[model samples]
Target: MSIRLGLQIPNFSYGIPVADLFPAVKAQAREAEAAGFDTVLLMDHFYQLPGLGAPDEPMLEAYTALGALAQATERVQLSTLVTGNTYRNPTLLAKTITTLDVVSAGRAILGIGAGWFELEHQQLGFDFGTFTERFEKLEEALQIVVPMLHGERPTFSGKWYRTESAINEPRYRDHIPIMLGGSGEKKTFRFAARYADHLNIIADIDLLPGKLDVLRQRCAEIDRDPATLETSVLLTVILDGYGAPSDIGEARSGRAVSGSPEQVADEIKRRVLDVGIDGIILNLPTHGYTPDVITKIGEALRPLVDA
Candidate 1:
């Protein structure tokens, strides 16, 4: 398949006056499905970013949101952009994903990473460990989670996590794709090369080619086929009537594929051709989720893949 296009639903309540945001969330999910988007991702955050608002301001639990979206949409795959590994116990997380997969009929993608955002971690009383410790915990968590998903009784006694004979029974029909999210060369990409079925990276169009090259090298070192590891980009799109910048040059801020549909499509095509990326997860603020932008993107971009 050609590159897949997905949407990331930012969790902020962008001035949409509503007692509840669930309906808006559902509306965006429906729009993604209607727009021929491949996946719809939700953020896993307990608080709005500091300047934005309060701790409990306009946020939805990731798993709960996914379950709701499971009931809402028919085709678009649902997942978190990356769940914080420190948020839940690995065993429970495995079961949760298995349940979500079953509910979504095997359309759940588990994108996980070592939890960052020290402020949130501290406030929530989740252990905001040293960076090295967090990485170690993440590695152990994956070891436990991946095997359990495959119906294996996982046993591990790492420094961070100790589990004994924990099993996830009646695994889903298809193995849920494990997507590792991060661009750390030493530990993140290394783990992705070893275990991930897909890799999510944030990249400007300029940096993408180099990052892909590094990933390929890592894959080779691990005796893994780079091509087998599906590459995906997380992009932020700011679509206004004024149109995007005319410069078709390198991207900054790790945000690529922003602009008018034609301009965005051209950038996307370049990324696919040069870096072999198979999918893009577009991050849209609430304003950018308007039907006009969605329709324009779908009409201008879907043919590149569908054709």
Candidate 2:
């Protein structure tokens, strides 16, 4: 999937009552679909991340939410911004995403990463291995996952995972697109070139061009055309009319796009797209749940991404 302009719903802490949460999520997905967004994404985490909110803050499981969202909206693609590779067995993940693709009628993108978030791993009793170990696990996971998604039964044994002719059935498509998220020029970039259909670069705005250069080099190492892998950046946006400027912290402002919708669009063009990045995915963690705000943001940014 070529995600020119995507909306990621990274926050779920609207002040509304608990019963209203899924309704709020549905509204955001429906509004994003209506406003010409190509995809809608959720974070794949058991708890909220550090910059977003406290760990106790409300967060829904990604696959369950996306399954429900598949029924709630039409046309827009669905996925996690990046599923933590450490969360589930590779075979199970393949089954889950293939099920999502079937339910969403072939609009599922498997966005994944080498899992981080040490606290979640600690509290949830997951193995938080060393950084190098995590990448190694991720590489092994992909070897099984990519084949399973392609309607192949792969019998594999590895350091971290093992699968015996694992079968994934009821697939909506012969292949579901895989998008790898990260800025690692060594491991992530090389893996994206090797197996992924898209690469969502997660780095500072200033560092993007250099990252892109290294990504090309990685692709060249494998003799793969860089264009075969689509690229995008994730932005934490604070629209001017939605909330006060102080809602954003000083640290995040370096990567955030905060301004009027028009100005936000302009800045994204100058900062992300003009840097030779293919597209952008925005998350308004503080204010995007409001349907009107989602519509406005989508209206302003849609033209920039439309071919």
Candidate 3:
């Protein structure tokens, strides 16, 4: 399959006024769709981090933002980069996603992970358990979500959650693709290989092959087909005017896919051929999500792979 591209809207607490942010977000979503991106993702968070801005800042709720995007765009899929498992009950999360999928015309994906950001959870009065306990909670949440998506009444009693025959209405027309986000070698990758339709890993081109090897080994251990899982990387991109290789700064080196269109295209080819990534989610740092960059990349690289 040809590589799919996605756009990640980083949930930075905007120092700019909300009046400016809303229009920019809508415009960017529309621009991404017009650029032929396969998906658009939002980060799930309640409070904004320090240095980025204030604590109780202009952070938009993930589901509500997605609902707005569902009405605004027609083609691009909408999802959280990874929703915190402890944020909401699985049944309710499933129903919320079902509603989004229906409204978006079957363009919703569930990207979920074990809850992280201890400070946020602690401040928000949610349980911040041990790492193992959190993963256990995530596994249970998956059990609830998967069956509920299949139009079944799910009942579960687990360490972190108890649902009494929860039923989901307005059945989804298609199976909402489940995307597991994380690179934990032991538990996270194993869970992705076992259950997820797709997997999201951090964009470290050098470490990708090793990670894939680990994922394949885990898949083998569970007798799962490794190729069944679609692999994607979340890349932070910084597009700048073409410069000499020696002029590149260390800070921008691996943190982003910078340089000219040809240089970026070459890097993408390396990720596919050398690292074996199936897709990439390009995250622009600022509100500089221009359609030109997308067109340039698409023009340069999209035709090379057999779709």
Candidate 4:
């Protein structure tokens, strides 16, 4: 499934009442859908990211929020921007996404990555292993998850995980789309070529063309067609006159696009799509909770993706 013009709701600290938090989240999702976004994603973290807010800031559980979003909206795909593999067991992750697919009538896309963020692990009791170790775990997880999504009960044993005939029933579809997020040419790109249906490259804008070339090489090495693996970039957009922070541009130099809606669209086309990226997933970390801004951004971006 292609995520052309996807909206990622990465911020939950709306400074509103706790009880009314979800209503605000629902509004964003509904507006994104109405404004022609094809997919809506949430970050899978127990705490806010380092740059986004303080650790204690309000952050909803990702799958729980996505499930709730499944009920709140009729269209638009639902998923995490990329689930941290360290957070859950591989077989369990398979079951969880399949359950989401069932709930959303087959609108689930399993976007996963070798999870970063050490504080979450230390605080939450998950083992934060070395970088190489994390990639090993992610590869093993994919072995278990990809098969389970396709209705095969995989019985496997690995250094990090083990499963015995794991079954994921009540599937809405026989297979769910798999999306890998990251720009590591060695591990992430090779795994994407081997296992993922889509790849969400999270590199700097100037590096995208080179990343795409490496991704193509990865696919060639695996005897897979590069076109079969859809691609997208995650862009931070702070529209003009939307309470944007003064330092956002410098803070997110190669990963953000800002200005009037038209200018934002032009920047995205030039910086991302023009470089051969297939699609874009935008998150308004500073001003996303405002529904009108979401509508405007979606209106401006819809044509580019649709074209």
Question: What's the lDDT for all of these models?
Answer: 0.77, 0.90, 0.76, 0.90
Off by over 4 Å in 1: 1-3, 17-20, 50-56, 242-252, 271-273, 286-289
What RMSD, rounded to one decimal, does every model reach? 3.5, 1.3, 3.5, 1.2
Q: Assess candidate 4 and give its TM-score to the true structure.
A: 0.97
Ranking by lDDT: 4, 2, 1, 3
- Residue 82 of model 4 has an lDDT of 95
Better of 1 and 2 by TM-score: 2
Task: Name the best candidate (by lDDT).
Answer: 4
Task: Output the worst ten-in-a-row residue range by lDDT, candidate 2.
Answer: 242-251
Q: How would you encode candidate 3's per-residue C-alpha lDDT over 1-307 as one tens digit per residue?
A: 2227888777543346667776777777887777677788988888754423356666789999999999999988999988998898898899999999899988899989997888898888989889999999899999999888878888889887888888888965647889989879898998898779888986466778888999899889989888888888877655565222332232254546666667776787776544777887776553244446555554554543324
Model 1 lDDT per residue over 78-176, tens place: 888788899988898899989899888878888899988788888779998899999998899999999888888888898878889997866665478
lDDT winner between 2 and 3, please give it: 2
What lDDT would candidate 4 get against the real structure?
0.90
How big is the positional error of residue 30 in model 2, measured in Å on the Cα after superposition? Answer: 0.4
Q: Which residue pairs in model 4 clash with each other?
A: none
Say which prediction, candidate 1 or candidate 4, comes out ahead on lDDT: 4
Poorest 10 consecutive residues by lDDT, candidate 4: 244-253
